[model samples]
Target: MRTTPLLVAAPLAVALALLPVMLVASGAQQVGLWSPWTAAPALATGVALAAVLLPRLDLPRLPWPSALLLLALCAGLGTWAALTHGEHLVVRRDPGAYATYALALARYGGVPLDPGLDVFGLPASDPWVRVGAAANYAVPGTGADGSATLLVSPQFLVGVPALLSGAWLVGGWSGLLVAPAVVAALALAAFAGLAAQLLGARWALLATALLGVSQPVVLVARQTFSEPFSLLYLLTAATLLVLAAASRGQRARLPALVAGLLLGAHLLVRIDAVRELVLLVPLVALLAGRRHPAAGPLAVGTLLTGVPAALATRWWDSPYVASVASSLGPLVAAGAVVTVLSAAALLLGRRVARRWDTTGVPRAAVRAAALLPAVAAATVALVGVGLASRPLWLVDSREPYLPGMEQFVGALQQQQGLPVDGLRTYAEDSVVWLVWWLGPVTVLLALVASVVLAAVGTRAVLSRQPLPRWLLPVVVGLAVTVLSLYRPAITPDHPWADRRYVTVTYPYLVLAATATLAWLVGTGRRGTRPAAAVLAAAMLLPTALATLPLATARTETGQVAAVGAVCAALEDAGPRPAVLAVGFRARVEWAPVVRARCGVPFVGIEEPSAPAGTTLGQVLGDAAATARAGGYAPVVLVGDLTSAQTVADATGVTLPPVVSLRTTEPERLLEERPLETREMTVDAWLAPLP
Candidate 1:
């Protein structure tokens, strides 16, 4: 009847064992590492590691019926996610960027990706044609030899791409698309394990089912989003940490070490993980002060993995690191301060306690410390009130971060019939945003639960009572959620921006709510138990209503077919190698696909200025001359009929539209919710140089 720690350890162990190998192989540019022949051994090693680590944890037992129900729930959710996965191949957003990164890694095994642009033989003086630096890609610097090698590196850290690369190698595009679903399922199972440990098995099932069906969870799971992987890693890590805290002696050491490693590995997945890691310094130190056997190993393991991964990210993806440096700087500073303070506390805590016991202290201060639990509970309620009431008084806005973002927001506002305020961020309504998807009942329940739990935790700490194993993870999760809700730091758009909640907030709230419900049912008077059950069932309505419509109707449908058509069109243009010069707009969407999928060198044409015809003409003329001299044909690809004609006039060739495919893209909603997609057309003209 007991579920072994294998359910949690297996996934974490495999991910941990494989991550290093994948990172090393990709960094070394070893294409063979992605092959089945080479990957099988690595997978075997992961299984072996899982087996070795499983025995170290003391996981709780669950009823067989409850376990079966949890399994069935995960299975159904996974199937639904895979069946309705989005086709986000076009490089329009983060999902597209992730897909392209995986494709390149799967094909070439590394980055600073060389698209073989040297064949174009273009002079460095040409300003119109850029060989690298497409959307979501960075041109770090020149090659080692000082030649003008246009090697482009993928933006963001390599963790998600490394995971996706394995999927790409297995099933190509399909595997890559479906990978998030598998991760989501694993994440749900991990959540179940954590919940079981914290709230017991029956409540765990309820919590898992509630979270698994939530809109944000479902939306992210159906595409190649990094949130799913983050969720899986974080939940699994928390589960392992719970098991470690429950155990005694050397048996706790391995799980604690692995838990710290997983927490550190989360940095590789998302740089923002620094926030969570920062909060852990004090928690780990407290455990160390308590003489918990796992504490030393956990701290050591965190540094062992985190320091190196952070440095590697800085080295390989400096541009991304630079972009977030504003926020990252403060977090790192806070982490440093916390670490030093925690160390000081661990070293001198008992001495200080002895001195404090002998020294006279103020009774008022003692009374204040005893009342801290009530203060914490009231603070939670106040925060909830402030967030929920923010929109009534505040209108959050900012100058556009990017050049065209203002205009883009304006257009979206107009489409949704909102007042035209391009600068408006709509961040003030974030609490309402949660209410829209989760419903007010669930939100209220979460708030009440948070208040109750915060009070309990403070009481436990102030009274020197033994803390539950779940206390650290829950506290950390609550802290992170509050911070995220305060400053989402994303473009305020529905569904697209909703991804912020998926990482920690939604799951934390769900767990809090379910745990509270379980408490009410178990501890309340007999007459109130039925009321708790009814309240539990009622919470599902709002979440289900919000999720079902979008879940049934897949967004970005036919995009995979559209991409295939474009690739085929390029192939039909010639048997000889060709340099594809993409027009500015098309380059954002197709440049990566052209280089990686079609296996052609891609050049992006800068936007034309005044005298557009002359500008286009000069750029195409130079491109054709350089391409031919290097023994390759030159072709121009544009996104629209007008751009096609512009290229035709520029090259003085009869350019015809070579590819036009229809598809659906997610609708951009301002204040309104997004439940469906709108039709879109992708057009491309390949003007082969005469």
Candidate 2:
């Protein structure tokens, strides 16, 4: 194979590149390998140069040189973004939970909800609600400090935290900073490899570039999000499936089984992947079965991996079940069931048609077999809708946080709205904003590519011959994309703009679009090549232009800056004092960060909503007593202005005036000033209790 060198070099290079991760994963005695600054840009430049120079050098005529370069681009840029532009401290409460999860994984090999380990260098003496979801609630019991240890949420799948833990092992707090971007690069590489095989090298390369610079990718890449890992798994499975479908005998069996393993493993990463799997696994099996007998092995492989993961979900302290029990949960379950049943019906119908063809039964009867499932599906959907029409559990479940159907209908009655407003409104607006991110040209080209792929797929399916090579990706991509639309808003507040919703599948959309263009602009053509090149350049120009801000943007800027300021203020205040966190939101977000970064044990004041809540005086007195008993000279009370007033009204102690700290000053110690900044203030006041 012309690409043999690339195939070999790609894996080897990735392995060599990820040596730091390998060492951490293997429990090497050493600490981190490369400082983010020292290693990231250097690697990025090297890989990028390889992309530009490797093909021109004419070394072994490696296939997919462009794709390799794109991989490098994504990996390099992602790493660079992380090292220079990343936030080391926990910003939002979610990342804090993951940090705790990573800490637990690093220290204990699994989550010990109440590990009592030193987080961010502070011992877990008095546990307060660490904020975010209830899943992170470590203890239902009260502690000696009169505060219960409401820990960080454990809502996420273990995959991301487990990966981040490796970073934790390698570089402590800082190492995990770039974990998301780096993992996103892994996803880009996986996609590039798959695209090179399915769509030519040029298309794969363009796809990689598009994904590398896109706003969504760039945004998610820099954060401690899980979608990148999920994307990596999905792309890997797709790659293996492509290989399995194309190969024969044992060659086919291995990839097929591995593909299934990866597919099943997806469940362990994110519960939502199950919706895609329900449609995808069966589709792959049917497609592969047509060419060869790989479906059985694939199914077996899936069972091998998926069963244990399902069992773990049931047994583990994961919030997946509880969260699912909410409205988003049933919607996903229904979608999965519908997708699987739909696929099964199609397969069963095909079999029935073939069997009846031999017996010479009425063609109508054969068609009815397939149509029966479709009818059943429609009936089920109607029943569901009818049930939903009344005050049903599913409809009722969604009301508290999001706009209910009644509200949606009222909005529609007032003004005609998007059919599924929650999902559609976000998705529609996000796409437009994404175009502004990737440019209108890229978005338009991608849409064209989707149409072209769809047309090609229709032709292949209608024909008697083997399905076109492009049809596989087309089918999978289209199925996944459609299923994505059905995704009931997990985050109603943010809706589709929350890039996590599309990160896994967005790369494929770009790949298909770029590949279609590549196919149109074959090297053999004269004017075609330049014209296609122009189109490709137009598609990428916006992405390139937009990359600077996206890559350099400060994620969770307000929160991180606040935490950094607090850390600075605490460190500057001589000896470490016991911190009293006064607000619910403050304690949830900042308390953990304070303890972790400053090694200060904190006493949290319960929110007014809590049972047996005391007046402001009791809250102040408790905090003072806790600090005094802990043998701390001064008690640092922190909260936003509103909470500060509550503290003032309840306390007799003459606390100092609020101090304003520069967010930039503390952050400079970790990396240079962020390329962009936000206007936010972190105010604090202190009191010394004799």
The TM-score values for the models, in the order shown, are: 0.93, 0.71
Expressed as tens digits, the lDDT of each residue in 1-690 for candidate 2 is: 335446323432432233223222222211222233433454465456335433432112235556457557766866765764445344332455656555545554443233221211222442332333222444343333444544443556665665676677678656776777676777777777777776666677777777777655765666666677677767766766666666666666766675676667666667666666666655654554364556666777677666666665553444445545554465556757765775786678578658866987776755764455345435434432442233222222233323343454345334433343332223223343445556676656666566555555554543345655455555667566544533434432221144644555576667756776777776567688888888888888877776664455554444455555666666655465656666765565455455544556554555544554456566456555655555553454655666767666767565564445434211110101123444444456655543
| Best candidate according to lDDT | 1
lDDT of 1 at 197: 74
lDDT of 1 at 320: 65
Candidate 1 per-residue C-alpha lDDT over 1-690 given as tens digits, one digit per residue, 9 for 90 to 100: 444554455456556666565445433432234445555565676567666765555655566677667767887898899998988877777787888878876776566666555556544445565654434544634553467766677767778887787788888788999999988987888888788778887888778888888888988898888998899878888887887777888877887888887888788788778998999899898888777888888888788778877766654447666666656777889999999998998889767666777985568868998899999999999998998898899998876543456787888888778888888878788888888788777788889989998899888766556666777888888898888777776767777888888988888888888877887887868767888877788777788888877777676777777778767776776665565555665776777766667777777776535344446676667667777786776777777777677677666777676557777766667676777777877667776776
Q: List candidate 1 segments past 4 Å from native.
A: 1-10, 29-44, 115-117, 131-135, 143-146, 315-317, 344-348, 357-365, 399-407, 417-423, 608-614
Task: Tell me how far the alpha carbon of residue 534 in candidate 2 is from the true structure, in angstroms, after superposition.
Answer: 3.1
lDDT of each: 0.75, 0.54
Look at candidate 2 and tell me the lDDT of residue 18.
Answer: 35
